[model samples]
Target: MITEKCVRDSFAEQAGYCKILGSSFMSDLLTGLGKQLDKSTETGRRVLQWSGDPAHKADALALRLAGALHALARSGQDQALAKFYHNPELSSDAEFIPAVLSAIAANDDELYQWLEFAPQTNEVARASIIYSGLSVIAKRFGLPLSLYEMGCSGGLNLQCAQFGYQFKGVEFGDNASILQLSPDWSGELPPDANVEILSRQGCDLNPLSVMDADDAAKLVAYLWPDQPLRIARVEAAIAIAKNDPPKLEKADAAAWVEDRFQADGAKGNVRVLYDTIAWNYFPDPVKDRIDQHMHEVGSAANADNPIAWLTFEFDEEDKGPFLKLRTWPGGGQAEILASADPHVNKIHWLQEN
Candidate 1:
């Protein structure tokens, strides 16, 4: 059912997403990259028949090339292209991009290996929106929070407490922390609440270990070349994670949620389940199991102990992704909170916090 146009269309949409997210450099590069894929080169053919789900078609190919280019640039193996990524002046010269891409695609072995892996964006900038939501939940519940994240690659966000946060001019977390998040915060600030992370754990189908050099490189490589700030944040987060890595397990999300909800939380812990942009990948049955489990466990929740689900994901009919929160003991009805750009560039708060 997959046609070449299907592949081309995915890239075109992804390119637009990059542009809207403030990465004009990535937008241009991806536009050029799509044309290169249409040329039926070895790389193009490989991408044309991508074996993964349709939702990931474009991202899978883009990440493969980006990761390979990043590896080369980091090793100083391709000084010309390395400078292109580091210096905006050189990369903006559109005339030089085709040659650079061609040279990158010439390495068949590397590209092939990259194609074998899925795109693990593991973007940490999104932590800004997540932090905002979590702050709201903790304040609403007034209980020590126990966090569990699904689709947590490298589990960097699981270490969010270690990173500093700045929302609408209010700041918190380790001020000395290198990984600070001060996004273009807008709207009236949510009620300031004390956050206590009693425990944190995460699960990914194929989890990357921050402790492993090769795994860490893949995580860093997936970052867009033009966004130096994002690249820097990933590097800083990796360094922070090395000291104390998250308790990440390689497991299926539905099964993990079932097990987590079935177990009893300590006396006063508020069990929190959350993820950013990871829900769409779950199959229908998996989604059903998780939903049913949440409802069943939620019915048993009491005021002294609680359960909350926080999600930042795409809503097909909405202008952008919606931030929805549902809490038990008060009845787990979904409350639409905010709509944010795909990369969390800007957020529009919809409810009074």
Candidate 2:
């Protein structure tokens, strides 16, 4: 049972993250709301009495509430709330607090319903790290790759190479691409190798497609209002994805991996399973099964058809996610390439590559 203390703690915890992620307004808003949320209202009752662990790594309860309110503000139904959100620095807590409370009371049903779904921020900026990892893999194996991603919200990162990147003075990808990113980069550059992806596929329990207007809106909405650059980057990436939409399927990741993907068949091409900031959402059972299947499949792998598991995800030891790579011959042992910001603004490469 999630205690009231735990629920409140989650809001405070998420507020801290908001500050770290460069959203002082959101941090302030969450802190204020946690102290003042009226438990008598439907939305407040639902949040205060939530059943599950409400932490960002768990149910992300705070983010859900934040997203819901942001959506309402964007919809233009509450002009006062919209003004506060758009110009947060100019609004005082006295005005902001009451507007939020009034908004919650009026749209309790909608906000409550919004909390049911997890936030899917298919961040495109993280591609800088991912493409860099692929460079290392390509340099090592010198083979074309077959890319598969699990928990791919809209499969935007599946089409990462389609977007452009400029890592610390190093240029990569198509220069003409609309959604270009130059994350604050560190460490030596990986030796250039052709990362020709023969095919790219992704699976998720609830895959959002770039073609869906509602899904695209939600994807953009999940970003903090203060960080308009992040929001604009995702929007541009979504536009890029629409031209050559990602090949995505709605399916269980473990089931898909065990039943469909095989490490042995694709001769002369390296099979790569990669995910960016999506591993935490997987249930423990699913994660275990996926690991087991990879190990089993890897056991039969060879030099001609190598299998690689690449990830930009949180490990037990780090504050942020690490770019990790594990190969077939070296099953169960992953090399930590670099550590990066969750939203992909900075990266410190641990390895020279």
TM-score of 2: 0.87
lDDT of 2 by residue, 1-353 (tens): 78888888889999999898778878987887788886978899999999988998889999999998988888888888899878868434677878988899988888888889898788888888889888888888889988999988888888777878887788887668888899898887756778788888999999988898778778877888888888888888888889988799999889988876575566888888998887877889999999999988988888888888999998866556889988886664889999888878888888864
Candidate 1 has its poorest 10 consecutive residues by lDDT at: 51-60
Off by over 4 Å in 1: 1-21, 31-60, 92-107, 316-319
Model 2 deviation from the true structure expressed as Cα RMSD, one decimal place: 2.8
Q: What local lDDT does model 2 show for residue 6?
A: 84
Question: lDDT values of the candidates?
Answer: 0.77, 0.85
Please provide, for model 1 over 27-117, each residue's C-alpha lDDT reduced to its tens digit, 9 standing for 90 to 100. Answer: 7666666666544456667776765543434355665665666666776666666776676445558654765566566665566577677
| Strongest candidate by TM-score | 2
Q: What are the RMSD figures for all models against the true structure?
A: 3.2, 2.8
Which candidate comes out best when scored by lDDT? 2
